[model samples]
Target: MYEDGEYGRGLVPYLSDAMMNIGTKVTYQTVIYPSASDDWILAELYKLKTMQTRVFVVHALPDLASRLFKKVNEVGMMDEGYVWFITEGLTSQLHNLDHKEDLMQGVIGVKSFIRNSGKLFDFKKRWKREFRSLYPDDDETQLDTSGIRLYDTVFGLAMALEKTQKEKGDSAMDSEGTRALKGGSMLLQSIRNFRFDGLSGDFNICHGQLQSSAYEIVNIIGTGEKTIGFWSPKNGILKMLDNETKGIKPVMWPGDSPVIPKGWEIPVSNKNMLRVGVRIGGFDQFIDADIDPETHQVTMTGFCVDVFKAVVDALPYALKFEFVRFVSSDDKRPAGTFDDLVFNLSIGGYDAVVGDITILAYRSDRVAFTLPYTEAGVSLVVPIKDERKSAWIFLKPLEKELWITTGAFFIYTGLVVWVIEHRVNKEFRGAPHKQVGMLLYNSFSTLVYSHSKCLCTLLHIILSHMLFVWFIIC
Candidate 1:
């Protein structure tokens, strides 16, 4: 809806609440056209043309609405895929205005319902005759729904006054000698409880307000309008009065087409291109923007650029965008930091920012950010010294505990060998020192594979083979 000062701006909240009750989400963007200048209207219309929303609910004075419709038609917005809905203020006055058929061809509007009856037909004939006599030159003037409603209001008031006069005297004087209605409150109560089948359908006043039975849904076709449907509180939108079906009749939309519009589209015009801001002198691996000297066309590349392009490609509709180098306003060069870029975005400098921007809490408060495409963390690195300078460097290959464990295993193997071989194989006789020396020789010789003594028993041979395998492993 266009946010004019008088009507459209004030109805936004009520319209939002009504739509919300019906489970529909509505986002209102206000385009203010404060003056009647053509340039101001055209400028606001251009902004609307770039937006994705095609459905509009207009609530403005008849003069402003007429101007808006004429400009909209000139810009080709009255073509297919656009839907225009006007409220009762403009709809009730449409019958008296002689607007162009093409300008209002596919527009839809709602006004108070006036049921067809012999009494209503006769009233229209009398109204036309009287209006013609009063202003003969104004042939376009006709009785509208507002006139019918006014007639009902006047008739109901007259009936209430007549009942008031019967109950009490016509006038009562106060201490100041000023006359007033004898039963003022009684008259108000009578008016509030009044109900009658008037020219404008059923006129029932509830809670001191006139209750509408239904609203006529009209579509502008040729020079006049066609009743496409009716919207009642009990049954919602209905194609016919007799049926319970909940839908409008098929309408001949703008461009003379019968196909239903999708009600939204991505703007592809060059003037409506989406401006994407890129960080200018950042780390080149993440984002880089270059400008040609001759043609002045910007070329954006790097990891961040590829990611942004992929995201756009995944959308169901085509999005036209151009990458702009984000520069400082003072120097016209790259901005100092990401915070500066985000602040500019919040103030309407760019439509979107694409780069390696960190998701800080302060930055998030300014502009929305996408899910972080890279992992979040920090890493520490230390340098290693040369090992060739130390004589004990060989011990660095294994821990000190591993070296001690290896030596203990070697001594244990020597003892096991001596215990098994001493029973039979030791040349069958030997001194204590000689046996001890022989044990040392047998155990240590396995490491160099220089043992010449042969095993006489199977147990000794098995121990010797096990020691040999351990030697090879070491």
Candidate 2:
């Protein structure tokens, strides 16, 4: 499911084509629901239930995903049989969104693997401090993954420009002034070949795009998430890092089950409804096997029955089913173990048994089982204690070193302008009051590009050079 937006629509073909090239046929339905509305999600889910498409690739914004998953959880649709795969767009922004973690439990996300490094951590600390200082009132001030990409992008452009600037010699502006920065093409080529260790990871450009093959597979559990595995174009999905031989990490799936879901069980193309042998007693909530006196046919209805019917309806093809009541010989109740009930399926007494059947090691010999809807696992729950919490959290958006660096640069700019402009202008030839004011104005005006009309030409020249420096800094 993708958002009903132009960008979302544009991405569909790329994804579809990629899958099709690998001989995988793709069929999809687009959903356009009101933002953050559970009612709209439920309506769409109802349709999905009838079509029996167990796996869903959701390409939506984080806000929409939160609402959709909340509805999915409410309707009991986030079971083992269901799968939700989010694209990079939603996955990258998820960590910065509000209460989104709780809504995306058990979801699998594909993201460009951002390796941790000292430089990256330092950048993050600076970003956090600067962001808070700049926007003290804003609650959501975290730097997103895209911001790091943007940083690398700007750094790449600057490096490229610096190289081109040197090769083209001092002033790139031609006599006509139209050839300013004449190496635009050369700069682009330089950027395309740029390589460096960036904050995110290795920043190698190949085929006009970043050359990274590693992707992290994250599983959202509780109010947080973790990396359960990794996927590389070269090695496919692996339980751990390719170099690490450690076993796969435990996955806390939806509904708190550690059991990894088998994507799908029964194929949807088959036409026949499975002959389901339902146990009649013990617990009626799972399935209640009853007989219709008038039709003399076995009938079943309850939680398990509803779930079975829902899954069958969700299938791509039509299915026909007949419920057969399991009558134990010699008594109304089953005379033997639950294995006896499952044995009927093996002997052709029934094609499948849909009820509260205990899954065990021995049961595997008789018949295959779909993913269990019920959750069973042990989990370690811990309370998070943030000792760093303080009233001065607003200062967290920029690092102290960055703040100091910015202040030092501001002072340096004022000193440089005084040295250059003091000899060239009458404004610099004044008393201490006017001289200091002029110096401060020259340094600060770069931010607002403001100056008196008398000094426009001089300021323009200075501002032009300042603009280039500002661009690199930004």
Candidate 3:
């Protein structure tokens, strides 16, 4: 056995038999703790420190013999940092006592530990000085896995059987025969090229991992349980220590797959999701028609939704929004668009403005606007020359001084009314809504004031007509 990889006191046979008592296997069945990461082991204890699993129960022992006897865990030892038994409840845990200052409570093991009564076990080697010997050139903290691969005994057996079968059929077991297979080094590639099942997953691997020897776990740990969803191929990646949050950063692994704990979700940062909202059911100016919702998002012909996809792709991140809305003219179908830029924004409309939005700014303070994604062509409106000349003069721009005078007059009158309300009615200054109402009422009433009530009423009615202004503009 190579140094740390050797089986210490595991020569005893009766101990292995005792472990089968706690956990029996069907087809060598045992639940693996997903990973053998030191952090992985400690973490499993947290949610189940008071509870117990075959793996957890085995890890609780003191002496190597005891732990070996309890070999009920479906996982391999993760460099043996801490072992604990729960017969003493959740307390009386074990760890590298040199780093762990509190050894007064539980029995400390320099090389090995055997409980006073309950069958607890200790470690194969003393960690306090053993670490110094393991890494003579560098500190223990600098230790890294230069070559590692997470192994699956089940997969190994399957591969061995496959080799055995292929050799029997044609006596081809070496790479020479491997090269004869159509697709390259990858078993997935070979499977796709040929029609034979070897390993990895069912139906021959195509997209993901292959059965190349380049991917192999250095360790073959056995227990009685099957772990799922975790089997990292040995590739270069950073890693962490046994659940230690302090002074730790990403460490690279060269060969074996690092074990991840079962049931622990991988942590991920809150990434932005691409969002896009369309003016669904709004006026579509392209073909000049409103969208009808009774039709599915696809067109009335059941072909496509609005050309919103095209427009959204053309838009910047501005296309994202909490709500999804799209607009399409009844005459035209949705235009498909594509983008490669990372988009993290959204789009949508505010409070029920079900009308049209032309090239004019709506509420100035409501939203921010970018330079137009598109441009409109210039338009010219010829000035009508009134032959009489008087009406045309008013339509032309006024003199600078005349404009200033009229603006000042409006400002002065407004200030006077404001001051009066502020002084005479404290409540007006506090709220001022009533004062504003009165000012508007008085100004309009004075605009159409007349000696005859009938004429005043008629003039007021005619001036307030919105259609009158519309007609004049037209």
Q: How many pairs collide in each candidate, listed in order?
A: 0, 14, 37
If the candidates were sorted by their lDDT against the true structure, best first, what order would they fall in?
Answer: 1, 2, 3
| Model 2 per-residue lDDT tens digits across residues 387-437 | 468777767777889788877777777766777777767778789888788
lDDT (0-100) at residue 395 of candidate 3?
46
Better TM-score candidate (2, 3): 2
lDDT of 1 by residue, 294-393 (tens): 9977788899999999998776445789887877786356876788889988999999989989889988888999988868788789888988888997
Comparing 1 and 3 by lDDT, which wins?
Answer: 1
Candidate 1, lDDT over the whole model: 0.78
Q: What is the C-alpha lDDT of each candidate?
A: 0.78, 0.74, 0.32
Model number with the top lDDT:
1
Candidate 3: where is the Cα deviation over 4 Å? 1-363, 370-474
- For model 3, residues 138-256, the per-residue Cα lDDT tens digits are 64541111101112233443564565446454443355656353322344433333323222222223344434322111111121111111112243211222232332222111112
Candidate 1: deviation at residue 65, Å? 1.6
